[model samples]
Target: MAGPGAYAAVWEPGRQNVTRYRLTPRGWPEGRRLRLAILSDLHVGSLHVPLSRVSELVAATNALAPDLTLLLGDFVASRARIASDPSLADLATELARLQARDGVFAVLGNHDWWHDEPTQQLRQGPTQVGLALERVGIPVLENKAVRLDTAGGPLWLAGLGDQIAFLSRGRRPRGIDDLAGTMAQITDDEAPVIMMAHEPDVFARMPDRVTLTLSGHTHGGQVRFLGWAPIVPSRYGNRYAYGHVREAGRDLVVSGGIGTSQLPIRFGIPPEIVLIELG
Candidate 1:
């Protein structure tokens, strides 16, 4: 669902350049404002996208000084060019530079599967890059959960594997049932629940226990005409563009993501790195 190469191309009215969203949701507890940055779909390795773009994105995000950082997926392109290129080494290095208060959490994306040829590998594709990320201190979560203790309290964060994994194997991806159980394990009564998922399609069956869900994969349909994005690919259709939606009494923020994929050009849609404030 990332744009042509690896970014979103939507315009934010009044902002000279494209801008990411800063969402503030209710029931977030008083004096517990949490600022989170969400970036996704870098699709590194394609000629369409360059490593410098992502380095710039990290610089901009660190400048914001967010409480936590969440990476929603598609860190690399599985296309032939990138799949076989050694340039991915630099791409991984650039991503490891991102800084956040609590820490950075990531999930995998469809393009990752597409480029990696996971079928041939018959192994957990993210492990290679995931380990690389860990070498630099970033943690990749696949159908797992981690609790972060912040000034507000302990935040129970859960991540689901790339839903596209099912498309290749014809079976449900691993972490569909991870959320509720993770929430049950967290003892914090103040810190709210958070989840990072790549595709917004899971919105249809999202659990209500989590206070907010952060995702990216639609790329705002890459092109919007007459205020409507006509080619939405995620399971939610137009419902999965760049914005907030209430599902089962919980809120979801789907970022426009920060790179391009198959094609480098962006028309109405512009790449964005979102900032979400929960209080």
Candidate 2:
């Protein structure tokens, strides 16, 4: 029943934008700057999100020349039935082209965990996706943290498992995110902590120790009218749906993301790759 305009909007996956922001967290050192490029919700194998777009995305991110790169999750879209699609290895190979001084890191998303839902009934997708990314030299952090020695200073990067995965049937599912366990890896003298979580709902539960959290699960409601999205899949509704928010004495950057879910069309809310600069 949709018209030509609707189909055009849904099929134009190449329509992406670069969003930039500057943040100076509480614990950040004085007179130092760090640039981080974030790409999220790249629902590859989904309608309109083809493998070719992956190459273009990589090139665009590299052009930004960020000090660090973060992938927020949902590399593939979930479907009721399992079928042959682009191999994760191939996808990883293309994503490996990303350039960052510190490194490129990632976390799993709900779709990655539920890729086989209602059909194959297996939870191996997340593990396989992680392995593929790791094989390509990208570390997939699952409730884990790492310290990167950037030009600005030492930075603590932490990643948590998908909050939705905690409620879904998946490999080693948990009821809630383990932020404490991930932060335990950092010491007192460590630099500011930046956490990557799939859903922004975890922002409300985070402690002050976390300086920033990056997420991309809502897709900015996937559709919008007059700057308000009609439908958003979050426990907090549109509260953490998109853009930057300061909460719990910390900062959260929720990317609109580069792919669609449930439906492929987007109106008003275009896909984006976030460029965050911290000083």
Candidate 3:
């Protein structure tokens, strides 16, 4: 087993690796290309992902000059003490600096919904986090879709709420994610649809209309050795744990995400920001 210092050395909080991918989808216009930057799983309260790192992440993402920026969730580490973390607000402030031609869009994650343990009397973390991002002009899409007119053409963007909240929390505190309703908003225009879902497992249920899906909850197994991850938090096992996956002609990009969860150790997989080019 590695010692604590070794783990700390490997978990450089402000370090970010950029992973790029190029995709050709049938829905994309012939001569037009769109660049999208995905940033996920900041986990601000975690020792391996301090709130101070938000500025670095924002700078790196802005430098890419993507047409659209997607903020996949896990802003907080999910510890009970996170409620008291003063840096959460500051993290939102830094995130507000993120720039894109269309706009900055976001979706919640399991950690963002984990406001309290079952034993706690009150749960308010999810609401607070959403409000923070909205205050900074980041629209948090919860089972809703938006249409953006880009130079290429009309683009459809839809997002689902964190699956954990709908499946476990009963959705009373927050509304349930309606994938069907979200897709219904897409007209017959046949524009490219990009769905933002925190968990990649949702990709399996996506219809053919969705051209691409983006997610970042696995943390790329957080620890991997010999090309095998000992732990992956997904019902689909390692199938959607990381990287680009295509199913039924729909593409899914699962980011490894920045920050540690449960443990502050990363072996072979480093935190990353995913840049996707679609044409």
> Which candidate number would show the highest TM-score if scored against the true structure?
2
Report the lDDT tens digits of candidate 2 across residue range 71-111. Answer: 99999965632465688899999999999988899998887
For model 1, residues 1-279, the per-residue Cα lDDT tens digits are 654334323333111223555444545766777788888766665444466667777898888888888888877763655335546557668878888878887877776655555543664554456666766677888777777886556777888776665343766444333545545565656557788888888777776666788888887775676656877767567887767887556788887665555544455666677887666
Task: Give the 10-residue window scoring lowest on summed lDDT in candidate 3.
Answer: 116-125
Q: For candidate 1, what is the total of clashing residue pairs?
A: 19
lDDT of 1 at 228: 66
As a TM-score, model 1 comes out at 0.82
Instruction: Give the runs in model 1 whose Cα sits over 4 Å from its true position.
Output: 1-26, 83-86, 118-120, 123-126, 166-190
For every model shown, the clashing-pair count is 19, 0, 0
lDDT: which candidate is best? 2
Report the Cα lDDT for residue 210, model 1: 69
Candidate 3 per-residue C-alpha lDDT over 1-279 given as tens digits, one digit per residue, 9 for 90 to 100: 567457545644346799999998656678889999999988887776666677778888999999999998888885655455655567788889999998899998876766535412343334667888888888999888999997557889999877776223544334356789899888766678989998888898988888889999998888776766889998788888888988767789999999888877777778899999888
